[model samples]
Target: MPVRRRRSTALAAAVATATTLGATALAALGGATTASAAEAPLADYELTWGIKQSYRTYVGMFGSFTASEGAGQAPGSGAFTFTDGTGTYDTTAHTVDLAFRGRLVSASAAHHFEVTLTDLRFDSGAGEITADVTTVDTSGATPTKKGDDVPLAKVAVTRTMTDMATTLTTEAGEYLGSDGYAGAAGDPLTVVKKTPPTTEPTTGPTPGPTGEPTTGEPSKEPTTDPEPTDPQTTPATREPSPTASTSAAPSAPATTAPATTAPTKGEIADGTLGWGVKESFRAYVVGTVAKGRVTVSGGATQSAGNGAFTFKDATGTYDTDADKLTATFKGAVNFKGHESGGSYGLDLTLSNLKATLDGGTGTLSADVNSLGTQTKGVVLADLEAKSGDLKAAQDVVTVDDVAATLTAAGAKAFGDFYRAGTALDTVDLSVALSDDARLPDGGGSDTSGGTSGGSGTAGGSTGGGTGTAGGTGSTVGGTGTTTGGSLGGGSLASTGSDIPGPALGAAAGAAVVVGAGAVYAARRRRTQGRSAE
Candidate 1:
């Protein structure tokens, strides 16, 4: 009996120890999880800089110096003052964003004084900054521009936080302050952390104009509508200027400029259209261009009849009142072919283009049937020769408004092409047309009656009869027209047509592969559109 009691006690002690250890581990794990769910403390930072310089040019001599500093993303705040051989400039009194920089231009009284920022950089943890700034002077006796590559100011910055610190050193470079800046050729800046940003509620909005509400929500109170006034003459409802007299007339309500009037039908100048095209292309390039991925060049059109010619880039002009945009684009987009070889171009000619931005921003689109060149070198030829009608969706301009013109069904189709993140829909290219292309006899293809048909060969006669592929006398569809013709009993729109004909020609097999790609792209785009909806 005694032996049994001793064994029992030993077992109970072992169980008790195991239970304690398990409970301790569970508690520790719970504490870790809770700590992880807590928010991290925010870090605040600031930067300060200054500059001074005097120089002579063919025009005259100029001199100036400026100082500025800015607070960093939330929680940190401070000011930097600059004074040296250069004049004193303290931007601490002025508003500073997350960056500390300033722009100094020729003082109104001094024509020679101008500044530029050439090069600026910061090391890791010094906010990891790298930027090159230039000048933007809208008015004044514009100073002759010097090379922007000159280093105007250089600085070494050290950022020290309670838990961590970093120092950044930069090479001396030009100060291209055309944009505005105050800093020396080289300087040292020290930044220290202070109080953290608070989570307190921000102050409420200040009163805008007399009678205007100062609350977050629009007032439910009934109000009388102000009489319409000339947009150009309408004064903005701003806080009364400091110099305002005690007896001021009622303030005008804030309002947007009236929508622009649309161009008269068929009245848009080619130049206006060209400008719009250039703007659209520039916008696309800005958003899409990247190294080793895509490149674009020579978007302008030159003179015609030269064996190698290109059509002019399209132009666009907005009609605010009409809430419509008129534009035209004609050019070639080249696609990189297989790794081994083979590359080609898609020659496009768009005219008489009008679009309604009614779909709002990014919905300014156009759908138009395209005419295909019978020329051997063009990729559109392969598709056109196979499909009776070539379809095109070109979103020309993006603006905010209501789309009212559904009649321009073609334009609506191009809306998706213009929408954001559709750069891949565009084929990037580089080319210089040796000569200009002749405008089509009637606007680069016709879209007269239904069952559209046009014709072309090296010099083939125009007529109204369907001919087998490659067979002379085949009638081609006019631009922007849909035809009901099919090849090999397959719907021309379907991917099953494997028949070889003049359209495919010597490159029939290759055309099949390329045409299939075009079809796939079109289908994928449509799918994406549906999914978005």
Candidate 2:
């Protein structure tokens, strides 16, 4: 019984020790987890940039036509500066202010000018610098010649130097390195290193060569060495090499490698031309001409034409300071126009052609067709003189109005015929010439009357008159009749002479009466009524 008691006590003591060791192990594991949670994570970061530019001007004509060529050319240049133009991390919005100053390059007829951009900045993180410039005019001045505001010649240009791409690469930790800038006062940059995982020595049963469980007395429990009571000394730390460090150290945390934030030098090519508005007569024309082909955009229509009489590559700068676009087209233009019975050839040139842009409007002026030529059936002459102001007419009678007037005149003439009761078989119509319709020579004759042949008549009256015949006497009864005369006249006149004077007189008078009576009868029978003329 004594020996058995002693063995039991020993077993109890071993159980107590095993339980205490397990509790200690659990506490150490908890501590390791807490230390891991406090460790810091590595940080990696990049920087990027943007640029903008602009221009402005004023230009106009200055004198009288008769004196000093009548036109003045004014040219000027300007500069602008921008600064802090830098990139930021953590998605922050920022702005840079720009300043502009203008200089009058020339104020004479022969104009010369130059514009410069001073100390412009491009704020691209990673330290990149670039510029994007555009010209804007606040001045309302425009281009004119001889005090005349010529129409259809205005030009505004916005040019971008897309090829002006640049890049910048800053040392990775320059701004946030340990012992380096902390960015602001009182806040020192601190780098924390993560703790490595702690592993416990594993416990397991020993196996016999026969692969059988031959545990005689359980092997003695292994005792973990007590953690040193003296505070454990951390490993000595070595300074990190100026270059990247390869050796591991306790005091110095391994650096969180900086991510590369290098700015890329952008590849630059020609940029597309953007006209503020659809080109009108007074809008800028953007295009390229090569070989014999010209591709142009920006006018009312986009056109491509070949076989130009004169072909030359043209280049000119847009002076925003002068609000003028000066271009020289060295190519010759062969144009033909069809008129009534013939066609005319025109040789057009660009002599002193100046363009101005007013807002969205454009105006151009130049001496065209200075030298004329003729081709087969084509006459070359002063086009403006022959065509009489080919410019769109501001005042001209419309076809519709002229037709209305003729219709009204016909209606009036027809009404007059209807009131006159005239059979409209043949209406001779004629237009009376207005006083203004005189010939160029001044004097003019009236030919307004029109004659028409038709059947018609009119009537009128005259005083009425009649004649009567005296009573007739037969020759055989002459002698008997003489008795009546005898009663009337003293006695009848004898057939022969020797009668008394009174008797002779009575016979002669009777003869006269007979003759008169016969003539009256004849007149009465021949009479017919007269008609009015």
Candidate 3:
């Protein structure tokens, strides 16, 4: 009995020491948990943005568009919604990296475009949202793909998640294969952040591994402490529960987009156009045959050394999708010679030239004054510029001597000086685009690569540009309902759509599993403990 009493005393002393030390360790561990909770990882995100409005409106005319990976527009709404978003937010850095699912396709008469957007990276310091973009243009006949992981747009975002307005970058314009896309506005964005979920602290006094009941009151000495193998030592396994830390787990932060600077309607404020009516016509007017001279007025100036005519203060629109240009210039040129008795055999003047490009043809219209007979909007020449014949650079589209044929009306305008369908001068033309404007062809012109009444289709990612003259919307999903597309998209829902989200609940669950594992270990140690004899 004495020996047993000695053992009991030693065990009790050891238990006392362990209880004190475990309390200290618990205090320290609780602090550690609190620190961990403050730095929670991002578990999920919901981001919303439309690519661009006018672009959508133009493409929507091609009928509704289909979506991929379950991304689609809200019913009857122009905004798009993406669910199950996945990404991370860095609290200290105030940055976010995210990715969503969705692919959109649009087409006009003779052209098709496919765009997929993902991997959005937001930097608060830089105040930009950069996304990886991939696109395919079918106008090249082979469905050329470009802009793989391109920096497509600039976005505004900060830690507070305000002002998610977006606009396309010049790179996006290049990705879309048109300068008119630069600085195009998109829908304002919104964010819904998901936090890392913590395991709830178990209720009541944590059950001891030993099946004994505990007093229902808090105390310095725990009845749950097990017998120490040595009086000088406490149980090596004693530790605090993860409950305190998990409960304080923080949530993911919000995301925002930046702003844009441009004319609201994306219209041209000022521009210029350079074109020469015809090389042969100009020479003939100055040659000994007609014995005539050419004169210019009204903002029209001849280039130095008898170059092309340069007309200033141009006003018009450029269509990127259709690769069409509609512009009217301020200028006039007159050719007069062959004077007779109160009559000049050759007298011609062309003014206010208007240029229109539709499908594969370019038309030059002008106000003609032939010997006192005035005519307006006369189709003076038909220009056929082949692909690779025109060069575009930094807001300038250039054509070097494209083939131009005189039209029937043009012959009469010249007092029948030349017959209808006569070979006119090779045409030289150049026009500049304005940085302050965006021309998305919202009822601007019908110059799609296909003829006015030709058949075309909006194609799908796989393939679809086939059907009637108005064409069908290319699609892979049935969610596409034709509410806003220009042509027929039999399977897509076109409501001025936006982007979607990704799934990331697994992140929060992972941390929870870690905390639960620690609790399980504590219980297991207690369960395997042997009672003091």
Candidate 4:
């Protein structure tokens, strides 16, 4: 009984030790996981930024006319200044304030212009931020001949502030990096204002009385010139004139005309240059040459007729050629492979072309082809063709090699023939031809040689021996002799040639045995008896 109790106690102690060790190990693992999480770097952070910029413009016009000649309308100088207040920029929304003022620099003309902003929000990020000044306040003096001020048709300026956090890193525990923060030069705060059209009051002429004429001459003269009244009123009191009483009749209430509101500022729509058209103006998302279809709303206009206007996928099209184009998008423009959200320019071309999202700027050239003496030009220069069976993002169809093929005289050509004109100029004119000409196979052998040899049997055997003879005799010997060779004048011997002695004897013995076997046997027996005696 005592030994059993001791064994039980030892087992219990072992279990307790194991339990304690496991708890310690589990606690250590938990601590390690927590440390790793705390030490891990932050992926990214969101920030609100603001920017304020000032710009000055100088325009010069030259012609054959001078101030005295008065040939040009406004051949003088003009100056303008623009100021944009700070705006908020976060992942969600972007807002800013824009203002402008312009004055005629030359004395020949007097000019004045002003544009104010109430609230500008860029949610879709499709088009750029711009200002347009239509009516100039020429309330002051007008310009003479050469010094006339030229009214500005419109002024457009685009600005973009990017989220630097994508390229920046922050401490493990820090909320955001230092470079993540952005502010304007003066740290100016945004001011929101209500901008409504100004109302004008209408004026009316005064009347003499309800029924009296308000014309050039008075309707009635003073009934009597005060009957030659003395300098002082006879009664020390004068009655109020009828005309004065009539003028007091609530001078007709001024009527104000309803104010006409101008169109909203910086309103733009989101658009796309559908599918493969993004890289090249070659085809639509359906693999057909883009028919140059462009649809725009929110007061937008096409800039150029050629390649400038195109569709990418089904979203919308941008007419970069249009000046001062604006559109209001119903939804945000989504791009493939990019997480950041904003309107991006589809300014892609064939070579060195880049698609810029986040409201970036880039330039593209036009592609031109020559036919005889005429040149056909493609407005969209940077066009690319995709090979293989990879579909484009945004539900854009893949363009096959056949659909993108261009002939030598087509508007655009690719591959070796694209530059054939230059090659033709430097080509050699002299060369010789052969009747049985053949190209060397890649293995460095004349393939034509094998074809020239007609079908025939191989003479040599696989074991390096000659083939069988025609008859049932032995095969022709290695020494070029037949099996049934001659002893002296046999069938196989050459005329006048000596036969070999050993070969000749063997043949003669074989022939004699066949002709006289019995006779030879009798003779041999007799010879044996004689020898025995």
Winner by TM-score:
3
Order the candidate numbers by lDDT, best to worst. 3, 1, 4, 2
Tens digits of per-residue lDDT for model 3, 238-345: 234344445444321111112133221234344555565644344434432233456677767665323356665667876544567667878677766445465655
Q: Report the C-alpha lDDT of model 4 over 1-533, residue by residue, as the tens digit.
A: 00111122223222333344565653564533422322211111111212111101000100011121101122111111222222211111111222222211211111122212112222112212222212222233222122111111111212222321111111100111011111111111212221111310111122212111112112221121111122122112323544666776555222211222212222212222211222111111101011112222222112221112222111222222231121111211111110113311111112111221112121122222111111223222222233222221221222221112222322122211122121110000000011121212112121111111111111111111112221110111111122344433222221111111121234333532232222223333343333222
The parts of candidate 3 lying over 4 Å away from their true place are 1-266, 304-307, 341-343, 388-392, 435-533
Give the number of the best model, judged by lDDT.
Answer: 3
State the TM-score for model 4: 0.13
- Model 1: lDDT of residue 82: 17
What is candidate 1's lDDT per residue for 1-533, written digit by digit as tens?
00111122222222333344465653563533422332121123333332211111100111122333221211100122211111110111111112223332322112222333322222221233333334323233344445422333333322221112221222211223211112212223432222222311111122222221122112321121110111111223222433374444233111212323222333333321111221122111111110001111234232111011122444554443343444444443221111112321211233333222321222223222222321121111000011112111121122211212122222223322222222111111111111121222111221111111111221111111112222221111101112333332111222222121211223323433344335323543454343222
TM-score, every prediction:
0.21, 0.13, 0.31, 0.13
RMSD per prediction, one decimal? 28.6, 54.5, 31.9, 48.2
Q: lDDT of each prediction vs. the true structure?
A: 0.23, 0.18, 0.44, 0.20
lDDT of 2 by residue, 244-361 (tens): 3544443243241222221111111111111111110000011000001112211111111111111122233332223222232222222111111332111122232222222213
- Evaluated at residue 170, the lDDT of candidate 4 is 17
lDDT of 4: 0.20
Worst 10 residues of 1 by lDDT: 285-294
lDDT of 2: 0.18
